[model samples]
Target: MNLKDFKAKLKNKIWRNVKAYFYDQRIADSTLVQNINLSTAQNQKKAIVSYVTYSHFNDWENNNIGRTQPFEILSMVKVLTELNYAIDIVGCHDLKTLDYLKLKNYDLIFGFGETFYQLTMLHPNAKSILYMTEHHPNFTKIEEQKRLDYFYDRKKKKANTVRTGNFYWDHHMKKKYTHVITMSETEPFNTEYTKPFNIFPTGILNNNFKLKPKNHDSSKKHFLWFGSYGAIHKGLDLLFDVFQKHDDIVLHVAGFYKDDRQLLEFPNKKNIIDYEYIDIQSNQFLEIIETCTYCILPSCSEGFSTAITTTMRHGLIPIVMENTGFNRLNELAFFLNDFNIEYIDKQLKEYSTKDSEYLASLSEKVFSFANSNFSIHAFESKFNVILNQILKND
Candidate 1:
């Protein structure tokens, strides 16, 4: 056999073996997730919240982060009921960390979190909104390193090493479900069984967050580079070196990170400020991001990130790598040739010189775009229609 074919076969075999190991270990956890779901599904048709960890006040307890979604789900359930639709949440299998409610009555199930696989057996009679939040590499012949990075061996795809069970089960359910929703990902499983799958705007902190005023020097400029570290495929290494060389402009960070070797790495600069996290919906959050003149997302892979949406909403000139998720953003944003700080500095300085019209235009284009397609009202309305379909079919 050719070397390439041999390599590909070897990778898949290794992946299969790892998946098998996790399958055996996670069976108990999956059962617990299932048992909880079965209990929640004991009733007839009623409106349900099909998402996960609505009660997690922090980013950790919940796999997904941003603004509150459970409340949004609750509100949507109300809207469904007004339209005479029955709703019940198939909260997947997170009864332990999930906020339990008296949801004995509902029409179908919704898959919002990590626990969806368990509901597959119990909720076949129910409809589901399959919202997957994990990043996976799709090719059976993925590189050895990529597979290891995605945690396929442990059944967990990156992030926490906990609860690796049901990777294959999740895939089967992901394909079988009538309705599926996902953000961008490293690996996407677009199969005939998933034809009904659609992409939707990520839900953010409900009406609790408003545009608070955040005035910056506007004259001076700062740049941002961000993403979750565990998913470094987001491309920080690609950009960091060039950023260090300039030492003139400021670099702001968001998402999770920790670097003590930082002192040794770029001991020369006083411009980099690591806030660790600025809660996306907090008033403080808007102000800090506003202080910067640019938003940088060096992502290798993505689903249309809400961060990008947020940057545009506030008029930060997003400097993103071309042909990535930032493809359509050319009209409203700028591009960098690479992670070269020289290129980044040139673009930032040129854009920073523009008057309010430029910023206004940037903000206007994004505001108009967001209103047209990504407004919360739009997300709720779209999901509501999908729910109706699930009801008809279920």
Candidate 2:
């Protein structure tokens, strides 16, 4: 390995070891085990699960992309608790804990993302469920592409792309789990799970995002590409190119772009406004949302775009590509044919000419849709129904 790459690997190894050591200590706490197992005496069903942590639920700190894990987990816990179910939380990071717990004995096993598949598989008789975060296979392809690009740029010999397949890649995991649940709007790509795949939409705090007076002039209407990290993977590269070509439509770019210097090349000139990394809860966030008629996210893949939904809650319509994983993009928003720059440009141009009255009507439609679909009430109702279904089928 090259000196730079070797140093990077060594640094990562040290960091991982450090984090692992602290996590081991945290899980070792005696009170931690008892607290999760606590339940009402009348409660009948007791579930044992692992991997999901309180830190996952803390949205403000994690800066979660969408479907705040804490809210989703807490909502599930609330439903289970109300049903008189005792939940024993287990930390999946430590193999010792898994061995000690005997996961199969629990009435239900709750797991999130791919790793839990193996845990569930180990306990064949365990009544388990997997709550997948995204369309994993598609996401993997993107990661693979990025790795290959890095290798190519470095002029490395025999640039081999490594495919690190996770639980999402394994179709058999479908049969392994009792049933699969996802935050995604549609069925994941290349899936063999014939059983019930429940689609539970994510919840958004109603008070956090409210409709504000927007600039009514259609001619001056701009778009905001609110994203985080993974700029290239999120298709910000394509967005930058597209925005540079179109002077008529102002595209305001927001969010943290890590290691992607291409954004620096496209100065905040022409019709582009680069407001890098503003707090979503800040007044500045609302101000930018108010100025824009549409929130553009031509993402390559997503389990669900929280940015799109959050913006819609503030009454900005969605302009997205097909595979954004948000199924509700039908009549309420505009869909790009592909992630091509030309297609995005064409779509933006078409949207730019839309009159003020039409934009106002569209905004109302989007707002109503967001309120009905993305609210906490809607989330709870759907969650309760799914919980009932899971129990009934079990």
Error of 2 at 123 (Å): 2.3
lDDT, candidate 2, 1-394, per-residue tens: 9999999899999988887668755543432243353645554666755555553324455454434555666667777776666776655444455555553355777765333555565666667877665655555476547634643453342233222243355453435466777666435523555664655455354345666556668523588888876665566666777777767778888884644553335455678777878776677887787688888887666666777777787788888766556655688888876665567777777788777887888888888888787766677778788778778755
Task: For residue 105, give model 1's deviation from the true position in Å.
Answer: 9.9
lDDT for residue 114 in candidate 1, whole number 0-100: 47
Q: What is the lDDT of residue 67 in candidate 1?
A: 50
lDDT of 2: 0.64
lDDT of 1 by residue, 1-394 (tens): 9999999899999988888778744542322221222334444344345454333222344344465354445446655665555444444556543334333333455555444444544445655555644333232113224423533333343333211222323354444665665543322545434444344454343234344433434623577664554333454443454456655667776764554223113234566666666666567666655576667775544445666666655556676755444555557767655534456556666665666656655655665665555555766777677656656645
Question: TM-score for each prediction?
Answer: 0.60, 0.77
> What lDDT score goes with residue 234 in model 1?
50
Kindly provide the TM-score of model 2 when superposed on the true structure, using C-alpha atoms.
0.77
Overall lDDT per candidate, in order of appearance:
0.51, 0.64
